[model samples]
Target: MLLKEIKDIFYKELGDIYPKEEVNSFFYACIEHYLKLERFILAIQPGLTLTKEEEQPLFEALSQLKLEKPLQYILGTAHFMDLELSVNENVLIPRPETEELVQWILADCQEKKQFKLDAERSRSVISTPLNDRSLQILDIGTGSGCIAIALAKHLPNAKVFALDVSEKALKVAQKNAESNKVDVTLLKHDILDPELDPGLDFDIIVSNPPYVRELEKEEIKKNVKDFEPSTALFVSDEDPLLFYKAIMDFSKRHLKENGRLYFEINQYLGKETEALFKAHNFSEIELRKDIFGNDRMLKAIKK
Candidate 1:
């Protein structure tokens, strides 16, 4: 079958449901994944054709797109930072905002390493080199191990641990960790459980926890609201900061002195979320805007 025909079929089927540009993106992504063809294949070879086997998956993907399934889920993969991760209904697709959160942590790590190196060079006695000292980092509610694995991959000296309440989600995270070639200790423990212990203090504790209030469900698109796991995306409207509160308590018990805490937060509740840090023993509270100019990431240091 002609590849262009399939692209036209995708537009005919999904044009109403998604924007024309988005439909084009979906079509191109499907072709790239299923056929290993570049997006410009049509421009270069306008008469390119697909075998029956190649046509099947594209049509199947189109059928799923018509139902508004997320392209990442349909493809069973998502890209976070430099890692391509396995994803499904068991895990929330890693978002660009989350990538920004990871990049923030990485930038801080790099800056600290550089500062330490400079300080050691000026000192007569150097006790320990920053490269030799391993940073202990933990990711709470690690849906697909995206944050934890990315940190471990970048900071090879750091020992990274990931915790998730759902066993299925942990499985996905473990798979992602192994496939990404990063060693992340996966713990299946609910952060909300007050008695549960992760058993290690961390230099950094991070979570992109469920901060979406139940009241905001209406604002979410159908693909997210209907297909993504609700448990991974929502909190009670009455207590929208439930996970943050629990993570704060957990950090108190498990964070090293001056350890940092980071979170990818709900844009609508930036101040409220930052207040959780202020009321506690945290300092240097900073709320950051994502590319969309919405307050979506927060960082604080444990005092």
Candidate 2:
């Protein structure tokens, strides 16, 4: 079958469901993944054709797309911070805003490391050598271990750990950490359990937990609402800060002195979320907007 004909068929089938540009993107991605062809293949070889085997995956993906399945799940892979992660229905697909959150943490780590090096070189303050103890980081609700693996991969000097309530999610996270060649300790622990202690002090504690309230379900897109794991995305409207509150309490016991707490929060409740940190005595509270100009990230420091 002609590749261009399949592309046309994709447009004909998905054009009504998605925008024209998105349809084009889906077709190109399908071709690239299934056929190992570049997006510009059509431009270079306008008469290109596909074998029956090559055509099957593209058609199958198109059928899934028509059913509003996410492309990442259909492909069983997602890219976050230059790392390609395996994903499935058990895990939520990583998003751009989460990438921004990871970037923010990376920038902060680099800046702090440089400062420590400069201070040591100048002999301004006597302190333990940086190598004496590795930086400790814990990622809560690590559905796919995207944040934890990225941090471990980038900050080689940091000891990274990730926690999730779901054993299935932890299995996925463990696989991702291994595939990414990063040492991340995956723990099956529920953050909401007040009595269960993680039993470690972390230099950094971060979470992108369930912040989407029940009242906001209608605001979510069909693909996200229908396909993504609901437990990873939702909270009660009456207590939208349930996870945040529990994490705050956990940080009180688990976060080291002057440690950092980061969260990817719901856009509509930025002020409310920040207030929780303030009430918990976290200093240096900062709420950041994502590329879309939405209040989507927050950072605070343990006093």
Candidate 3:
């Protein structure tokens, strides 16, 4: 089967599952992965044909696609900040919105340096070396380790730690750290629990913990509810904000004074998250939008 022929058959089987545009996009991605061809090359060489050897794997991969498995899981890697991360059912896939949280943190750092006018003056004011030196970050529920691994790669001087309750998740995180060739500490710990690792402090604490309400399950896509880890996606209806409360309380003891807290929040609970953080005396709490302009990220500073 030629590459063009594969595209025709692929859409015939699954085009109704996706829109015309999405089907096209998936066709390009599947061909790119199978052929290992650059997008520009693929474009320039439109007449290029696939040998039967290449077509065999293409059909196999496309079969998975027809099943509606996530493309990241199909590709065996996801691009986060240009770094490829291995993703599987054992870990939650990294979302683009969480990438925004990382950019927001970097922007805040740059803004602070400009506001102080003397980076040295800003450096002199803090007790910990994190303020004077580089940030040390801790990510609770690191999932696929995208947050910690991206930070470790992007922030040259900072040390990043990825923590998760599931040993299976940590194993994925550690593998991502290794594959990225970035040094990130992968630890097995439940952030919701009070007695975790004796209060070692961090300059920045971030998480995308479970915030989905049980009632909202009907609205979520079946792939999400059926495939993603339920423990990493859900909270009790009795306490929809349980993870937020626990994470914030944990941050109070684990974050250095003035250190920041970031969360990828459930949109419906934005106001509730804001009030919860405020009651905990967290300063400068602000809700920011996801790519879709939905309330998604919350930032706070420890007093």
TM agreement with the true structure for every prediction: 0.96, 0.97, 0.90
Q: Candidate 3: minimum summed lDDT over ten consecutive residues — where?
A: 124-133
Tens digit per residue, CA lDDT, model 1, 188-257: 8888999987668989999999988888989999999999999999999899999999999988999988
Measured with C-alpha atoms, the lDDT of residue 189 in candidate 3 is 78
Ranking by TM-score: 2, 1, 3
When 1 and 3 are scored with lDDT, the better candidate is 1
Question: Candidate 2's C-alpha lDDT?
Answer: 0.92
> Cα deviation of 99 in candidate 2 (Å)?
1.1
Best by lDDT: 2
Instruction: State the TM-score for model 3.
Output: 0.90
lDDT of 2 by residue, 110-228 (tens): 78777778898998886664441378999999999999999998887789999999998998899999898989998998899999687788999999999999999999999999999
Clashes of each: 0, 0, 0
Better TM-score candidate (1, 3): 1
Clash pairs (backbone) in predicted model 3: none
Candidate no. 2 TM-score? 0.97
Candidate 2: which pairs clash? none
